[model samples]
Target chain A: MNKTVNQKAWFLVLPVFVVVAFSAIVPLMTVVNYSVQDTFGNNQFFWNGVGWFQELLDPSTELGGRFFDALWRNLAFSAVILAIEIPLGIVVALSMPRHGWTVAFSLVVMALPLLIPWNVVGTIWQVFARGDIGLLGWVVNHLGVAYNYVLDPASAWITIVVMDVWHWTSLVALLCYAGLKSIPDAYYQAARIDGASRLAVFTTIQLPKMRRVLLIAVLLRFMDSFMIYTEPFVLTGGGPGNATTYVSIDLVKLALGQFDLGKAAAMSIVYNLVILAVCWVFYTVMVNADAEKKEVEA
Target chain B: MARIVLDELAHSYKPGPKGPQDYALKRIDHVWRQGGAYALLGPSGCGKTTLLNIISGLVVPTEGRILFDDRDVTRLPTEARNIAQVFQFPVVYDTMTVRENLAFPLKNRRVEASVVRRRVEEIARLLGLSRVLDRRANNLTADMKQKISLGRGLVRPDVAAILFDEPLTVIDPHLKWQLRSTLKEIHRELDLTMIYVTHDQTEALTFADEVVVMYDGAVVQTGTPDALFERPEHTFVGHFIGSPGMNVLPCTVEGTTARVDGQTIPLAGAYPDLPQGRRIELGVRPEFTTLAAKGAGLPVRVKRIDDLGRVRIARVDLGGRPFAATVPEGVAVDGDEASVILDPTRVHIYADGHLVAALPAGATAA
Candidate 1:
């Protein structure tokens, strides 16, 4: 076969450029402009290059301290959610019915939380955890825990963690379930003949087979929980002081509430960079882990 | 090694199967004697794998008991049965090295570390897998992975029997013969009762001391490979075993004389009594048939001749039905009119598709 080169094919890429310009490039360029210049009143702008970024990084100024505090808070939340969800998801997946109508029934039930919009989820939890008007808050108070999610930082944190776990653990479970289903019956039969204990079969066969899916679940949960905004905002409204204000919530307060465009734009750029950098690092680790897995399979 | 006996074994996928067609395996009473190499030969859906799983205690027969050396173990689980089985596909732990996979069975049973290591190395050597023992299992070819499966089954010192469920189905064509020979060698060295199941006649015949031919959920015959070829007890066996299969023609029998398609067929032995109201046929292998003069036997229209390196097969039409006769080299089948002469000694009479008896060549027709 002879190769034919056509320059006309480049026009086929026109729609993609148009979509990217409107959706991403234009908005990003606006943020870049806002980060470097101070704007006051209607359409008046003055240069303030790199000053906002320096203040944001110093952690001594009010803006800098708030940014670092929220950053740390986001990191801690991501870590705690990952620790609970991964194992719980795996257990739920392992115990789920392997065949027939029960599989479909359970899957739909598990996915119910995910189907609700994020703000709806937050509102539902907020009303559901009210000490005076809610079932769970009343039940917990009856048990003598003095629980009130609205009035204390500890109670608010607990509600947020529980709410997040309830909303997202199913995604991890579904991924793990799919991984488990892909293993053939032949492996189980072979393991039985080999006299493998149930634990041995799980550790050596099931765990190793589930490695790829577990990596995906971890990365999704990590990124999603780290940047959580709407749920916490609706439920706690960054309540009982700044306890539950994750970085996205803090960015919203600075940019929209205070109208500090220069500082907010610089913060948002650094926040997006952090997310991109963390995701890139995780993706590289996953890729290298896959290569190492292939070597083991070799 | 133990003599595995299945007494009145029957299985049905549906509970309370109401009819014969519902049974996956019709009731069967059979024995695989200690250290005997046997092959269960059948096409797909013939219940060979079901029977093998039963012996290994993977499947519990609905209506019968299985015994190992006279001890009833029909209700025992597969783990307590101490039997091994290799499946149709090569299954190995993809994450483990080949050595680790082979050692896995022993380690699971809590065998001493040194012993597990030694046995794994020994089995790996026997399988020609020692060179890649440290390599991961998923990196190997289909045949090599199957060999790892085989090695795992053989690693246990106290295994009652090792069953193969078409273990070489995925192996390459040229490698199948080599693996068959290796299985035979393993059987001989270990003196373990092994039952290999396959739909292929060549694989069954070449790999076993005796072949049990099954059709429609029943064992039709159990005999040595040569005996199966020479005298298949059922028409299905005669039809299934041969390359071109045995030529079966509708016949009526009385005493030592049989009439097929209005032609007299001589019998070597007398069958004094035969049941009535069932189909009767005479079966003769192509190797036992020879061409004769036009008036000597039934005349056939020569349709086609296949030159198969060693011998030419003459396919002829007998009353519009296809019949074949093997012709040795140098015997010409040129004439349009060809008569088929079946050797009396190699002739068999079947009633209702079941064998009545075989007649030797020298017996009188009358």
Candidate 2:
């Protein structure tokens, strides 16, 4: 018997490679070029030789001050979002009906916020949190809470967190719901037969089964939260001080606001590196967990 | 172990079953002895699964009561029923190891660690899964995963009854036989009250001591394999329980003889008083019908012959109605001239949708 090998299959992937190189690789190369050199007005450039990187490492300068603070804030935000969204998503998913028109309705509703553009989400929240016209702000004010999100750093932070939660928690919920739905009805039957309590069912059957998708949900949410720019930028304009200024917001301000191209470029590189490094660690953990799972099976 | 009983159970998906067509499952009254192996057998959408789910407390009946032993458990949740159910497909925890999957129910019940380990190991050994005890269930093959599912159900000896809902459907054909025998062995060793549900007649007949043949959501007959074969109370039972199924021919009965297809066949006993002008049918197993000399039987034309190694099945036309007859492999008959004689003692007569007569009995076509 002879086997046929077709080299023509490479043509299928050629388009994807071309598109990715044009959109992603070209821009990344440009970012690398800016990171290594100092460019003044009229496109005049000087070789800075890691000068921006050194300045970024130093804590005394404004760059260092904003960079480290934003980095820490981004990390904290990702953690908080992950902590809140995953459990909340699981709870919501569990409460959903197994099979019905309600499942379709809930899925459509959950997907609505994810479909809205990021900038639009920011604008919606900004208007929605206004003390005078916004329903949430008006309600809080009416309740005698003395809330002003634009002027108050604490309120601004709260509003951004709440907005982010409202916008992105649905993604986690939908992913978890899909995971839950994929589980065979047999497991529930077995659990019922075992006399497992509701809590037992969730912890043993639901949580363990959803682990893979839950990891994906957490990683995606973390990366998105860490690099959040448009929503906070539009919501508070990184105002009420640095309370709402995330790393991506700071990166934008340095690159476009002040035109400190070298420092901003270097910082952007560093920011990307940080996200990449953290994401690598998360990816490694997920992959190793899967590998270990496979090893156990083997 | 508990004796499961169903008392006047009928289920309808919609409200107010005004007539026969409205009910998904007609009223059934039966009892399953404690520690007995029983199978609910029927074709697809035949309420066999529905009845099994009702027994497992997964589906609540529209009417009637389900009793576990003597205690009424109609309204009890599945968790409260103390029944372990294995689904058609394997439902083991994909993220958990085989050991963990088997131990889950035990762990949920707060069984002692030593006992859980011992019981899990025992079941794993029984199912030939001990070698893969630590393997994650998702990585296993379909048969292995099904074995894990089966072991999970069997691990808890304290379960009142173990219900299998076509648990071997995902298993390969060759492996299904082995698993069936393994299940029978486990049932013997554990002496658990097992109610197996399957559409496969072979599986039901071979696996269960008493096979409950269900049709259109009601159990038409519950008897041993031989009894069900010999004396089917409903026409559906006769059709569903056999390999080629029973040949049912419309007939008119006059005293102790039925005239089917213009041929008179002697009835072994008197039939029950059936209303005049009521439609009647005569039922006979293909195995009991044999080829005989011409003028002594119903003349049939041999349409096709399937030589099944040991026995040959002849597909013939009896009075323009397609009928099957199992004959010896060497039986000589031309394609044009074949006559089949149904054993008088093995024939059945039905009236008003119920068996009215069985040969050699005080047969009533009621």
Best by TM-score: 1
List model 2 lDDT by residue over B250-340, tens digit each: 9988778889868898878866465677779899999999865455578888888887777888888888999998876467775468888
Give the DockQ (2 decimals) of all models.
0.57, 0.51
Q: Tell me candidate 1's interface RMSD.
A: 1.9
- Candidate models: Cα lDDT each: 0.89, 0.86
Local accuracy of candidate 1 as per-residue lDDT tens digits, B1-366: 799998998988788999989988998988989999999999999999888888887778888989999899999888888799999999888878898999999988899999999899888888889999998888898999999999999999998899999998899999998888888888988899999999999999988899998888888999999999998899999999988899998889867778877778888876656678889888999989876656666788888888777778889898778999876556665578878778888889899899996444345344
In order of appearance, the predictions have TM-scores of 0.93, 0.90
Taken in order, the candidates have interface RMSDs of 1.9, 2.4
- Model 2: residues with Cα > 4 Å off, grouped in runs: A1-22, A295-298, B95-100, B112-157, B293-296, B358-366
Model 2 residue B163 lDDT?
Answer: 88
The segments of candidate 1 whose C-alpha lies over 4 angstroms from its true place after superposition are A1-10, A293-298, B270-272, B291-296, B334-337, B358-366
Best by DockQ: 1
Task: Kindly give the stretch of ten consecutive residues in candidate 2 chain B with the minimal lDDT sum.
Answer: B357-366
